[model samples]
Every structure is written in structure tokens, then in C-alpha cells.
Target: MAALTVLALAVVAFFAYQANAAPDRPGAGGKPDPTPVEEIVPDKPSETDGADDENPALPPDSGDGVRVVYSLSAQRLWLVAEAPDGLGEEVLHTYPAHRSTVDPEPGAYQVTRRDEAIPGSDGVPIQHVVVFHSDDEGIVFGFSAAVDGSLPDPSAQARTGGIRQSPEDSPQLWEFAEVGTPVIVVP
Candidate 1:
């Protein structure tokens, strides 16, 4: 009886910690933080709708709402979310990545699974894996960061589905892309 009580308390504490650690998003399984985020307005607005050469804009065709956008051709990904005030969308972060040989067709998908750490198809230790799609051939497509800070060498191994990001960027992507979160891929 005492063991059961202690286990119940431990479970409650774990949930409480997770709720606080979760991102403050509508679909991220946590209550949105009531604090308003400060928006940094540029002194000189860009010529277009907030997009500039330095910070590439998301493809106009990408559907709205909070989503992780992946561009196959550019080998880049962006984490976008609705502005706190509900005015417009904001790009929280973007970074370049190394993709594997097999690519998922351009479209929308959702994060189906996540692993804190795992061995990638290339046998490299990886972390913060957020899997969104899998091909009919049994290849699982996901975003992850190599534990050793090295990208996959296409010529060194068989086709893999791990899209490798920098160690710094993987955690942010993992936090933003909870299961059921949308992932949009564009050409």
C-alpha cells in the first residue's frame, strides 16, 4: 500500500514537470502561457511581407497554423507558429539540415513518434528524433541531430531517413514538434 502511494505521487510530479516543460502551444498538450511575448519590430521593414534575403520566407502555399516546414530542395526547416496576439504567424526558428537519400513526397504530415535518443540507420547515435512520415518501403522519415555533431555521409552507407540537424537546433525542433503537430514539406 505504501509503495502504491509513493508511485502515485511520483507519477503526479512527473506530469506536473512535463506540463511546465511543454511548449506553450494550442496543440502541444500544455496550457498556453499567459505571458505576452515581445515582438521585435525592425527599424526598417522589409520590402515584402516580413521576408528578406537573410531570413527566407516560408512558401506561400504552405498551409497556416503552427507547423514545422521542411523544404527538400533547400534542405532547410522552419518552425512557425501563430503570433501570441493572434495577428499573424511568426517563424520561431529555422536551420539547415542534411537529408538522406530517400525523401518523402512533398505534402503535409504529422509527427507520429518521438525518441529522446536512438541509433540512426547509419549507425550514428542520434537524439531528439521527431518522426513524421514513413514510406511504403518501411523507411521512417524523421528529424534528428547526430550525437557527435557530424552529418551523415551519403556515400558511406545505405539509404537512411534521418534528416540531421545541428545539435543546437534539434532540441528546439523536438520541443516544437510534439506528436500530432503538422509537418509540411515543400519542394
Candidate 2:
């Protein structure tokens, strides 16, 4: 009886080991799966030809002597002028600009005059004048005069003034200056 019990225990252990162990090779059922490995590498830079060299110049509506062109769509003001070679145009200046909220206006704005001195400095003021319009969309154009010194301190006292509009326009024009409308820069 003791021998029979020992033999039974050995048989159970062998089956348990076989069930838990992984097979070295695939059985007749299916092929074994391959082990997966991962690798990482940095990106490489690529060379490119100068495609921008062939780009066309700004439209004629910008003006023949247009030293600068400001596009509301691109939100960028670019200065276009004749290059030194006198063949193609060159970019003289590029600046980010805040567009006007008024709709349906067109044209390239210009700085015509300055109204008063700047807040703090005894420098020149800002004034704008409309020179050209790209479309009859009713968009106005103008420029603010350049400041000579640093900007005024905001915490100081505020100046009070009122703006008046002509009888031919609506109340909106009176409240705020529309886009393309020139502003007189004051020192």
C-alpha cells in the first residue's frame, strides 16, 4: 500500500510540472511566436533647394513706390521696395499688426500727420492717411506716428477727450475710428 501511495504522488508531480513549464518548440497545433524587440533613433535633417526665390512680388494695388505693404489676412506688415539691382523687389521691414474690427473696407493706409505730442516725451505725434485701396471692400488704411522716446507710464493720470463723426455716417463711426481711417499722432 505504501509503494502505491508513493507512486501516485510522483505521477501527480510530473503532470503539474509539465502543465506549468513552457514548451521549447511549437507543438503540432501551431507555430511559435517570435520575440519582439524595440529600438529608438533620432531624426536626420534633409537638404532643400531655394524655392522661395521664385515667389512673385506683392500686387500692384499696393502702389508702384510701395515701400511697405500690410496685409490684414496675414496679420503682417511687410515693406516692399526695389532691390539694389533694380530688377526685383526686396523686403525692407516686417512687423506684426493689430487689424481693425470694421468690415468691408479696402486700401493701403499711410501716415499723413501727427496731432499732438506724445504723452511723456516732447517728441512727434502719430498721424495716418489713406493712399491706396486693394479692394472696394470699404477697408480704410492709416499709420500711427512713431514715438521718439519710451512709452508713457500707464499708472499716471488719464487724458479725457471726445471723438466726433460727420453727419453722413452712422453712430458706430462716431464711437470708434474705422479701419483705414487715419489718426493724428500727438506728442
Q: Of the candidates shown, which would achieve the greatest TM-score relative to the real structure?
A: 1
- Residues 1-187, candidate 2, lDDT per residue (tens digit)? 9999999999999998776564763442254332211111111222353113223234345554434455545444444445557886554433443333332234434433223323322122422222233235433333332233122232434321111111121111212223333322211
List ranges where model 2 is wrong by over 4 Å: 1-64, 108-111, 114-141, 145-187
Candidate 2: deviation at residue 106, Å?
A: 2.2
Number of the top-ranking candidate, with lDDT as the measure = 1
TM-score of 2: 0.32
Q: What is the C-alpha RMSD of each candidate to the true structure, in Å?
A: 11.2, 25.7
Per-residue error at 138 for model 2, in Å?
12
Looking at candidate 2, what is the lDDT of residue 32?
Answer: 30
lDDT value, residue 1 of candidate 2: 100
